[model samples]
Target: MLTKRLVTALLTAVTCTITTAAAVPAQAAASTAIPVPSTGEHLMPAGGVFEAGTAWKLDVRNAPLHANSAGMVKTVADQTAALYGGVAAFNAYQYSTSFYTVPADQPRVDVQWDNCQGKNYTPPGLLGPEGQFTQVPIPADAVPAKGTDSQLTVYSPSTDQLWEFWVTKKTADGSWSACWGGRIDGVSQSDGFFLDGFGASASGLSLAGGTIGIEDVRSGVIDHALALHMSAPGTWQEFSYPAQRSDGFDTSVNRVPEGTRLRLDPSVDVDALKMHPIAKMVAKAAQKYGFIVTDKAGCTAVVAESPQAEIAATGVDPWKQLMGSTPSYSIMKNFPWGQLQALPRDYAKRTVAPATPSTDPGTSPTAPTAVSTRYVSDTTFRTVRNGWGPVEKDRSNGESAAGDGRGLKIAGVSYAKGLGVHASSEVIVPVEGAKTFSAQVGVDGEVGTNGSVVFQVWNGATKLADSGTLRGGQAAKTLTADVTGASEIRLVVTDSGNGSAKDHADWANAKLLTPVATTTTAPTITAPTTTAPTAVSTRYVSDTTFRTVRNGWGPVEKDRSNGESAAGDGRGLKIAGVSYAKGLGVHASSEVIVPVEGAKTFSAQVGVDGEVGTNGSVVFQVWNGATKLADSGTLRGGQAAKTLTADVTGASEIRLVVTDSGNGRTADHADWADAKLLG
Candidate 1:
């Protein structure tokens, strides 16, 4: 639904630069720097991409609404309902923009101008009659936004320059070209707009401006206004202040002009709305910084930083965990649309008062420091398992027994205190109220660049950190996890798909931070004891209904093997060639809670079901509330089932849990064969 002028502008060169202006002082500094995978790659700087006074960075929670705010809200609401089934949505994975930051030392290559669409247009400044090109430092793996737009942005913090391209692509000869694009210099000092009518957006605004980044969502607070695309905008010549031009076509009196800012009613109780966590985040931002009409689209949509590039680089999709089961199109379904208050045209031109400086010293608080530290090697473990001999303290795990190992060494660095264990090992420690756990982990140098392993930390069902596939002699990775309020901590090591030969892994300089205990005297009274229950006839779990069930992949099947995702899709529950007619079939990362009615014992034979052959690996555990009663260490497919028995006396509910063995849950069909309760 974009106008003809906007579509045609993509076929020519567009160069933009910032106008000199007084810079605003930054309000606050970022506490922690975001970790970069490579040395030269950079993300948005501490405060943000541009100066503090830019329209996108201004705090407008108390801004006044226009006289015609109600009419504008009705226009947008009607169009939204017609286009998006009654609600505006965020374009997260597709039809959005992505950006990359590179260092000055990166290779500079010329991006040629392509007239691929056969449109008549003259090349702008910087691209002369000789077809000269400006060199850009783009990373090799950099990818543009997916879909038709193919928009890509590259920024250099060291140079304070930004380049954006539309319909961008790499040609067959490995050279880059775009139908149209622009470059901006002195980005940090700019007013968050393009000059000389050059930019990727139809309104001459920066593509990166107002776009929501992943970190903003993860932190549950967005500090800037959001960029919005609407189907109908005012006439092409009628635009607001931060926009140099507009591509609007609608001449209806109700059409909102380009650059018009609209916000949800500040009086609305956003938290009280039945909205998803992601929607609540957007709603709060809508009430605070509001939404700026930026471009034209088929439906009302908000811009989000495309997640494809990050997913490709890290092999992890953060949205999957952040949004959970909510689909992108419905993330904003519950947002309050009728209450939007449109600001007056040219809202950014209004004079605003500066923030008052704090006078009280107690207003700002520093980050808390560790109260006390204790070496994990000195702590007694509730459970410990090693692939080789015994777990060693203050040493590298030698192939034989305890105290037979050498000094704890990783990547040539020696440590005086730590725990050393082989792969396929687990060590559980009770750290009920610890602050944090930290360690320098790697495949120990004692292995001499031969073995590979992974280190992980878990607090119950939630995994805190993972060091993916560290090889011998590699630089040790610093692993730190927040364990506050966790009853127990699990430190696990697993072979990196290879056999566990020579996989000597070390948790060098491992320690826990905790508040020092305070002692007080108190009187106590003894209580009477009751008789233990006698064993009676067993009741098969398959014959009883579970109080609750949660699975990572498929639904929990009763008395059948976990085959696929559909209900009743599995065969008989089998492990190690033995079939069981009475049991429950489930996927890894599963939990089934059953009411025991004061049962004395819960027993099961747990293993990866034979239906998956040797493709799956898992660990089985039994829990009564937060207390773990039994655990079957890592079991793989084709392995004999391990018999598990737990004392469930006086317990009303018993939890059967299965988790992937330190790896991801893939083909992890697990069986609890002959599971029963006896009293």
Candidate 2:
């Protein structure tokens, strides 16, 4: 609607803005400088108000415009009226005017509404309650008025409520300015107008619903659909719904978005296009309810709502008597915005496709194996715009299971949501030229202290590999990259530090490792010498020697419930039943090669697995880098298993520290089964 609403208010973090401007003098505002509410107060909330509209009939309940089209709506309105030339460029007649009832001294000021909902909007900025958004006895100098992308409906039948406004200045610098409007209780509003679904304009929908407002030209007969307006907008998102392009389309894509409906050609013949009984009753409501391209002005227009709605419905002012009332703005000054017509918009009913995975997180055998040559699932990736489907698993908002688990999680990264907001996902590989793309990411639980989750890898736009920050559930970094043939590969996922709060994130077992060619021309014979890269040593477990561990949130790998090993780590192992924060949670850490003082003897097995002192256990310690040496004695949750020994004497580097046995972090998945240090 304006190139897709500043990219849908920066990916739904909505903010709008609009502040200063002037110019709205079209007469009205001298009833002795307006003013009448001496503490009467009741614009809305008496029953919510409604009624006061007059003279307007034809609306046989909707959906019925007979006469088949053999002319595909004037051949797409002559191919969009050949872009601004023919049909006199559909000029003038723009109005979003309103006033079901106004006279007690018109004006009514005192605004302030802005409901911004991006990442659910927070920090002292709701601006709703207080006076329900004033607007009572207005006129105060009629307010440095002006207009540009304007709208000012105003229903209030005592409270049936409907007061709409955008760029509605002079209502007395009240509050919720431009990116600030709303009140809507129900004048039907075609279903969505505010309450977040949006539509005070900028095409997220609703311009007095299907618009032609002035009670549809003294109810002459133009049932639904008729909101035309355009300075440019030829086509690229013919708008619908209360409008929704949060971002996209600027000097190009040629209009046709906002809530497009289009019509005309119920067999053409409107008295041979003689038009003008209000342009053939708005071309028979565009041959039965159709025209809706909503906005983008400066030239082609069709909005209206003033004339005090024909002096509050027929108190005379026959619109100065000729053939008009809401002052017909000179009855269609040559109407025909190029015969218009662009209907048939199925765009998958409204986008959201790529999400195939039935079993392939690349065969998830506890995850992590498919380094490519063929693997799939970046949720089956698909973005070059097709309506981003998969990566949306919202998890209500309390996220975990590594931030929204399964399907491409994107609830504002683990928490606070939206500062450096990011969430990518793609995959179209099979290039076969030069490859190497690995994955094992993490982040949806404890990174807390501040938060961090960066894990990039692009090929289309270049950026090769990143794993940089990472936290929640800690320990997970295998990211790799080297592409050459590149077919599309991507991943992105961000919130790098602090901002996106809890930073929920994960990508365990991700894969795409390809590079295996072989073929020598003219008679076999290969082997130029190569082989030297395999150093996999450093395995350690606890929870009593080796009850086998690895349960990421649920059923991770095996052994965890004997009432959560009821407090035991004494040589037989099995303690941590969830209490992980920094690095290892379901306990397990190692990096030995000691032998400094007495050669090595670190011993393990500790305790604390649930209630004894409530939920606290930290009998596990032994470091080298931030030096701690040895310590294991702090068990309560049921208690059992205890054997702590240390003798590296000089120590070189053999880390392991789980802490938080109580007081703060808990779900305690801490246990170090069979953790070694024998050297």
Write down the TM-score of every candidate. 0.47, 0.22
Judge candidate 1 against the unseen true structure and give its global Cα lDDT, from 0 to 1: 0.69
RMSD of each: 32.3, 28.8
- Candidate 2, residues 1-679, lDDT tens digits: the string is 1222211122111111111211212121212211211111111111112111100111112322212222434433443344322232222122344333233335565664432222122211123343335564333322211234344555432233465555555434443243444555643212334433233555444555545433233334544555665544433212333343212133232334444455655666665554445566677767655565655543345554433333433344322332323123334433554554454331112122222122111111211111223333423444341112333322212332224333222211221111111233333444344355544354533233334668787777778877666545333333556565786666667666456655545453344544232223587756556875543332233212222223322221112221122111111123433331111224322122322333356665556533222354454676667767777756555465466666654565455555554454343334444444454
Residue pairs in steric clash, candidate 1? 536-679
Over the stretch 1-679, how does candidate 1's per-residue lDDT look in tens digits?
Answer: 1223221122111101111220211111122333222111222321235533356655567776776788889988887777534656567665566777664466888887776544222333435432224778777778887767787888764466888777878888888887766777876445566644456777777778777766566545665677888777765545665665566768776778778888989899987887766677777888877888888766677777776666766665655555665555556665778889888666655222122122222121211121356778889874467998888888889877668888876654556678889988999977856776777677776788788899999988899878777777554555667688898899999999999999999987687766443333677845547765543867777667685478976678776676555444455577887777668889989999988877789999999887566778999999999999999999997899999999999888889999898998887889999899898
* lDDT score of residue 35 within candidate 1: 29
**Candidate 2: where is the Cα deviation over 4 Å?**
1-195, 198-204, 208-225, 228-260, 265-276, 284-290, 293-306, 309-342, 346-679
